[model samples]
Target: MQTVKPALPRPVVAVICDRISYFQHNVHAVPETYLRALHEAAGVMPVLIPACPELLDLSTLLATVDGVLLPGSPSNVAAERYKAEPLPKETLMDLHRDETVFSLLPSVTAQGIPLMAICRGFQEVNVFYGGTLHRAVHERADAIDHREGDHARAIEEWYEDSHLVSVTPGGLLATLSGTQAVRVNSLHHQGVDRLGKGLRIEAFALDGLIEAFTAPDAPGLVLGLQWHPEMSLGHSPLAQQLFTTFGDSCRRRQQSRLCTKSTGGNDEFISAYAV
Candidate 1:
C-alpha cells in the first residue's frame, strides 16, 4: 500500500474596496476595521484592491485571487441604478466599486470561486444578479427596526441587540448554523425587495425583512448576508464558521492552482483533489 501526503494551502486573498480616506493624511494608511475583522475570520493575509477611477478590466484583479470577501462600507448604491427616487439623505455611491464587482460576479462564480458578501456587498450581489432593493427599509414603519444606532458613531459599538432571524429548513444557512433561528446584529437601512434570479431566500427577520440569501445555481460557496459577520467573527461561533469555510475553500483553490502549475500548465492531468 502507498501512503498519501496532504496538499499545501494558498496565499493571500484580494479584498476589493471602494475609495477610502482618513481624517489625518498619513504616509501609510491602515486597513479598515471591518476588513481587519474579515482577515481575522479567514485567518489569512489580505491583498487590498483599491477602487480604480478608470474603467479597467476586472479580470486583472480576479486572476491573482483565490477567493473574495466583499465587505460592507459607508457608501450606498446609487438610486439611479435601481430606478428609484433618491432619499432626502443618502450616502455617497462609488461607481467604480460598483462596476468592478458587478462585472466579476458571474465570472467568479463560473470559475467556482468562493464568495461572501456582507452588507452593501450583499445588496450589490443581488442587484448584479437582477434583484431589487427597498431603497429605505424604514420608509414603511411596519418593517422591523433594522437601524440600530447612528451611523456616525463608533463602528464597534454601533449595534445594540442581537436580532433573531428565522432560517429556512433544508437551506445552506440552516445546515451551516444548525439552528432554525439565529441571533445576528443588524445595521442596514436597505434590504432585498425582489430576490435576484436563481436565488433563494435563506433567512429573514422578525418583521419579514430579507436577512440572508444564496444562489441555488451557484457552483461554489456563494452566500450573502445583510448583517456584518466580520464585526462579530471574534465573538460568534456562527461568524467564525462562515470565515473558516471561506478560508478552507480558498485553500483548496490555491492547491488546485499549484497542482496545475506542477503539471506543466495542463489541467487535464490534475487529480480531483486538486480542487
Candidate 2:
C-alpha cells in the first residue's frame, strides 16, 4: 500500500480595514468586492482585520497569517501627523486605523512578511517609514489630473485607461510588467513625495508622480502600487502577476512555518526533511 501524504494548509492574508460611518454609527470596514477579487487573483483566503487605533503587537496575528494585504479606503491620513496643512476641506480621517498600521509596520517588516499595499495602503507604507505625501496632488506645484470621476457616475467611463505609468529599469515592477509603460486605473489624489527609508521607487506616472515603491533590503516581499490591481485583475496580466507573486511568496512562508513546527526548532531535522 502507498503511504498517504498530509495536505498543506491554505495561506491566510490579512486585509486591514479603515473606519466607515454608516447610519450614525462608526465602524471599521473593508469592501467585500476587493476581498473577493484578492482571493480570485491570488488564490489565498483573506481575513479582515478591523481598524484599531491602539498600537498592536503583530506577533499574535502574524503567527496565524502568511501575509498582509493593505486595501484602499476613503479616509485620508491627517496632515497634522506629517507636519503639513490639512487639505482645503478636511476629508474623513481615521486616527485609529492610521496609528495601528503605522505602529505595526516596522515589526511586520522585521519578521520578513510579504506585504501587498494598494492605494491608501501604499501611502501608509510610505508614510510609516519616514516618507511624506503630496496631500492633494492637484494642489501641488506640478500635478496632473488624476481623479477618475465618481464611482457611480464613472462606471461606463473606463477610468482604468486614464493614465500610463513607466516602470524603472532593473526594478521588480519592471521585471513583473515586462515593459516600461503600462496603462493603470487612477482614483487617487495623494501620492508619495520623498520615498520611505530603505525603499526604492519602482514606477512613476507619465506626469512624474510616484506610482510604485518597494523595499529592496527587506527579507521578504514588500511592494506598494498606487493603482488598484484588484479592480484591473480581469484585463491586466501584470495585475495577475502581482497577486500571483504575492500568493506564491505566502505559500513559501507557510511551508517554512510548517517545517519549523514539525522540526521543533531542530535546524538539522528541518533541512534533512525538507530535502
Candidate 3:
C-alpha cells in the first residue's frame, strides 16, 4: 500500500486593499476575483489589509502572514513617486494606497517575504524601486493600445487576452509557462518606462512594453505581472500556475517559521526541508 503524507496547514496571505469613497464614506476594499483566486487557486487563506498607513503596525502585520499579495486596482500610482511631473488632474490616484504599499514594500523585500504584485500593484513595485512610467503607454510610438475599453462593453471582454508577450528565455515566467510567448490581457494606460532597480525583466509585449518582472536577488519569491491573471484563473493554465507557485512559496515560508519555533531557531533543520 502506498502511503500518503499529511497535508500542511494552509498558509495565510495578506492582501492589500484600495481606499475608495463609497456611499459618502471611505472604504477599504479589494475585488472579489482576487480573493477567490487566493482561496481556490493559491490554496491560501487571505487576510485583507486596509490601506491605512497611520493605523497599521508593519512589523506586527508582517509577522502574522506567510506572504503578501498586492492586487490590481483601477487607480494609478501618482507620477510624483518616481520624480516625474504629475499627470493631468483627471487621472485617478490613490494616495492612501500608494503610501501603504510603498511603506510595506521595503519591509516585505527586506524580510524576504513572498510577494506577488499584479497590474497597478506591478506598477507600484516598479515605482517603489525608482522606476518611471510612460503615463500614456499608447502614445508612445513603439507601444500598442494596451488600455481596456470603457464601461460600454461587457466586463468579461475587458479581461480577454489582448496580445502575446515574449517571456525572457531563461526567466522564472518562461520556466513556469514552458513557453517563450504567452497571451495576456492588458488593461492599463501607463507602463514601465524604465526598468526598476534590482528587478529583472521576465516578459515583454511584442510592442516592447514590459509585462512582467522579478527580483531574483531577493531572498524570497518576488513576482510582478502587468495583467489580471486572477480574472482568468478558472481557464488559464498559466494563471493557475502563477497562483499555485506563489502559494507554494508562502507554504515554504510558513513551514520555515513553524520549524524555527519548534526547534528553537535551529537553522540547519529549518533550512534542510524548507527550501
Candidate 4:
C-alpha cells in the first residue's frame, strides 16, 4: 500500500483588494505580490475581497478567517477620513478602497482578528482609529526623507533594504527580530503623525518616524509595519519572522476554532468562530 501524506490546514487570511482602472474600465483587484506572499511566505490561504463592503457579509468573512492582510497600494487614503486637508501636490486617491477598509476596521480590531498592515495600509490603520499622518512625511523637519528616490527603476530595486529602524525594546518586534534594530525598505511618503487608539509603537526609524506598531489591547495579533515585509521574504529574518509569527497565530486560531467545534463547546467564542 502507498503511504498517504497528511493534509496541511491552510489558515485563511482575508486580503483587502483595491479599486483600480484597467483596460479603460474600473474594477477591484488584489496585487499578485500579496497573494503570492500570503501563500508562499506566510503559509496561508488568501481569500480576495474584491467588491465593495456592501456586497460582502463581514461576519461571514471574519468568522471563517484567522487573519486579515491590508496590502500596500499605489493610491493613498483620502485625508478627509481623518479630518485633514488634502495633499498640496497632486496625488492619486482611492475613496472606494478607503471606504471599504475604513468600514472593516471596527470589526477587525473589535473581534481581535490578526492583522498585518503595510505601507499605505499603515496609513489606513492610523486613519481608521482617529490617527493622523503627515501629508509629506519626508519633508517633516524631525523625520528622515523616507521616500524611495525619484529615479525610475524596476520594482525589485525599490524593495532593497535602505535604512535601519530601531525596534522598540521589550516589544513584539524586538522579540521577533531577535535584536534592537533591523534594516527596512523605505518606499512611502506618508507616515503616522498621531497614532490611533489602542495602538502602540513596535518600531521606529533612525529619524524618529514610526515604522511599525501593534495593538496591545486587542485579543489577537494586530501589527502594522511601515516597511514591506511581504517583499523581504527569504533574506531578512525580521520579515520572515513577521510572517511566521502571523502564520503561527493563524494556525493556533484555526486549531482553537476546530477544537471548540469538536469539543461540543457552544459558548460565545465557539459560536463566533464556528462560522
* Better candidate by TM-score, 1 or 2: 2
Taking all chains together, each candidate's TM-score versus the true structure is: 0.83, 0.90, 0.92, 0.89
> Candidate 3's C-alpha lDDT?
0.90
Per-structure clash totals for the candidates:
0, 1, 0, 0
lDDT (C-alpha, whole model) for all candidates: 0.75, 0.81, 0.90, 0.84
Model 1 C-alpha RMSD vs. true structure (Å) is 3.9
> Could you give me the TM-score of model 4 versus the true structure?
0.89
Error of 3 at 206 (Å): 0.7
Better of 3 and 4 by TM-score: 3
Q: Which tens-of-lDDT digit does each residue in 204-269 have in candidate 3?
A: 999989999999999999999999999987678899999999999999888867675545566654
Best by lDDT: 3
User: Residue by residue across 136-245, what tens digits does model 1's lDDT show?
Assistant: 79887788767767667776677544589999999988888999998899888888888888878989998898888888788777889999777676577887888787
Query: How close to the true structure is residue 31 of candidate 3, measured as C-alpha lDDT?
Result: 95
Kindly list the per-residue Cα lDDT of model 4 for residues 17-96, writing each as its tens digit. Answer: 88888998878888788888888878999998874878888878877888899999878888788888876557888888
Error of 4 at 258 (Å): 2.8
* Model 3: residue 97 alpha-carbon error in angstroms: 0.4
In the predicted model 2, the residue pairs found to clash are: 53-96
What's the ranking of the predictions by lDDT, best on top? Answer: 3, 4, 2, 1
Local accuracy of candidate 2 as per-residue lDDT tens digits, 1-275: 98444455568888888877789887778988678866887878898887774534466787778899888877787776677777566477787788778776877788888999998999998888778898778777667777776667756363466788988999988898899899998878888888888889999997789999999999889999988888887789999999998998898887777576654566654454452
TM-score of model 1 (CA atoms)? 0.83
